[model samples]
Target chain A: MPDAHPPTRREVDVRGPRFAAWLTSAVLAVALLTGSGVLVAVQAAVFAVGALAGLRYAPYGVLFRVLVAPRLGPVREREPEAPPRFAQLVGLVFAVVGAAGYLAGAPLIGAVATGLALVAALLNAATGLCLGCELYLTVRRARPARTA
Target chain B: MLGGALALTALAAWWQRRRDGAVRGADDARGRTTTAVLEGLGVRPGEADLTVVQFSTAFCGPCRATRARLQQLQATRPGLAHLDVDAESHLDAVRELDVRRTPTLFYLDRAGTLLGRSSGAPRPDELTALVEAHVPAPGAREGRDV
Candidate 1:
């Protein structure tokens, strides 16, 4: 039987996602340190935009495509889009939870959520470790097989 | 707190890389699988000299790299077959094979006997060497030359 959700064949510039991760890491760090509800909300909005609109339309993605990629010369390889898109969804989950926590006056909850997201973002930015992609794979493997 | 997170992230990266792309021999007991399991993965018995059964997920970055490398090897090496199984769609095989991660590759001989396994994207040189070790030279067969 054919797989319903096959790995995407369409390639994307890997740098774009890493650049977005750098931005996300900075924003999440600020949100965690300052305990600012507004910052958390803003980060959440960024996550939402990235998750829904994809890297092409996301702010940092545009920045990478326009400014960074050209200076780096041609990339030898382009990665599939699914992994980074899944990572964006993971970021969205943390951002939404962090925003809610901040709005409810629970700074600790907000800090923890944002801190977790920051850790993941920093890992991607520094080491190219896509923890969210790993989580997505784990979840997919754990789920029961679908019956046609 | 931020410093601790950084340390943890570094540790995680180190650990992931240490194990990433390393191929090891499969345990004889655990690696044994019937032809039925191979059939489930759409591989016919004796179809090729060696079959690379790669279990992958849709959202795995390493899986893509693994696939590209394996396909490249398959293209150049005769009697090498590459089968990519989506773990999401083949949960039973995943469980039976005890695949805990994406891009887990099961190396099987022509008779469907499991030889080894690799959990992440294997290095191209290492992969080539491993395949060469398992597959006999062209025109060499069973202590007789064709």
Candidate 2:
């Protein structure tokens, strides 16, 4: 056999995802601390945009590409899009749940949801430890094997 | 609450980094034979004196780095083969190997016995040492170095 699998999709600057994670951490922190429905909704919208449009078009990603990336010079390494994209979907899940919790008059649920996302984002931003990416791998491992 | 989250994040990062790229010997208890598994993956036992089998997923960033480093090592080292397996498509092997993370690597000897396993991207020095310990010097194994 030639190989088990084909090459993955195009690579991305690893810094872009880290920058977005920093932004997500900040937004989630504010939402969780204030227990403000508006802030939660705004954070949820950010997650929605990222999950739906991908990091390339997301506001934070664009900011990184235009501002941060230029200052950092060329990156020697790039990573696959699947992990970070999966992370965005995970963020979307928590953000949407938090938004719904806040809108439904249950501040505790919103706080918990936002708090979980905040930890994941902070871990990625501060130390490059992506919990969401780990989760994505775990989910793949749990799924049934596909025909090779 | 924010302080707690920050502290927790720090702790998690510390723990993750501590174990991230470190290589350790495999457990003797788990001593599961991998010859059949290697055959299933199209790698016949004794095909190479030593093989570095890396289990990776599409979304894993460290897996890419590991692949590059291992391939580089293979270029200079004879009797050493590098095999990359997509963990997503090979769930049975993943389960058999008890791999919970991406970029998990299994080192195999000539007879396909699992020697050591490393999770995450291993440091270049560590990988070099591991390869050197298993694979003989370039000129020793004829026709094995390609």
Candidate 3:
């Protein structure tokens, strides 16, 4: 099958996504600790904005660009935006599920889903390795390559 | 709940760190899948003194980095070649080799023997050392033969 999404040429400073991950991890940690559906919902919205609205406009992206990027000096590295965007989508799925579970009184389900997202966020925050991005690549690899 | 997640995350991070870029000898379970896969890619055994076969996909960031590094290494070594295989396109080869992730690298010697394999972006020093050990210096083989 032809690639469903034509390759996007957009690239972002490599540090931007990592910075977002740090924030995400902290948010998820608080949500899990408090078992707060509202917190999970908020993070879900962040993930939704990131996956759908583009990273440049995402809240954490704005924070990184305005507050962090200025102090970091020149953009020494860049990466295509697709993988991390897909990762955001993956995080969104978990956050949404976790929110639903928490709000619906299924704390077990909430804990599981939220915990998974936390693990992924922690991986990205601490190591600059996105578990969601890795999952994206593995999923892509399982699909047939585009003929074109 | 938070403590459990933290513990799990810590364990995962430790495990991933241990495995990342660490080369291991070709396991016997793979049982000679390398030759057939290489041949399908138009490579015959012993064609190059050393071949670094890389399995990669389009969206993999580290795969791109690994490709650049391998390309640089190949450019510097007269007898070394780097082959980039689209893992998605070559599903059969990927399965045969049991490739679990992108940027899985197979290091092959002159006789096409699988020296080692590593999954994930390779460490620079280890990659360099592996290359030096496998690839002879310029005219070193010729001098030995003479």
Q: Give the root-mean-square deviation of each candidate in angstroms.
A: 3.2, 2.2, 3.9
Model 3 TM-score, 2 decimals: 0.88
Off by more than 4 A, model 3:
A1-8, A137-148, B27-31, B139-146
Output the worst ten-in-a-row residue range by lDDT, candidate 1 chain B: B137-146
Question: Candidate 2: lDDT over CA atoms?
Answer: 0.79
Q: Give candidate 1's total backbone clashes.
A: 0
**Strongest candidate by TM-score:** 2
Model 2 C-alpha lDDT per residue in residues A1-148, reported as the tens digit of each score:
3255457786678889988999889888887778877887887777777778876777788889898998997997688877787788888888888888888999888878878889999988888766877777677767777775
iRMS per model, in Å, is 2.7, 2.1, 5.2
Choose the strongest candidate by lDDT.
Answer: 3
List clashing residue pairs in candidate 3: none
Candidate 2: residue pairs that collide: none
Chain A TM-score per model, please list them.
0.87, 0.87, 0.88
DockQ ranking of the models: 2, 1, 3
Report model 1's TM-score to 2 decimal places. Answer: 0.88
Candidate 3 per-residue lDDT, tens place, A1-148, comes to 1112224478999999999998999999999999999999999999999999999988999999999999988999998887788789999999999999999999889989999999898887887776766665456647765542
Show where candidate 2 strays beyond 4 Å: A144-148, B27-29, B140-143
Q: Tell the DockQ for candidate 3.
A: 0.34
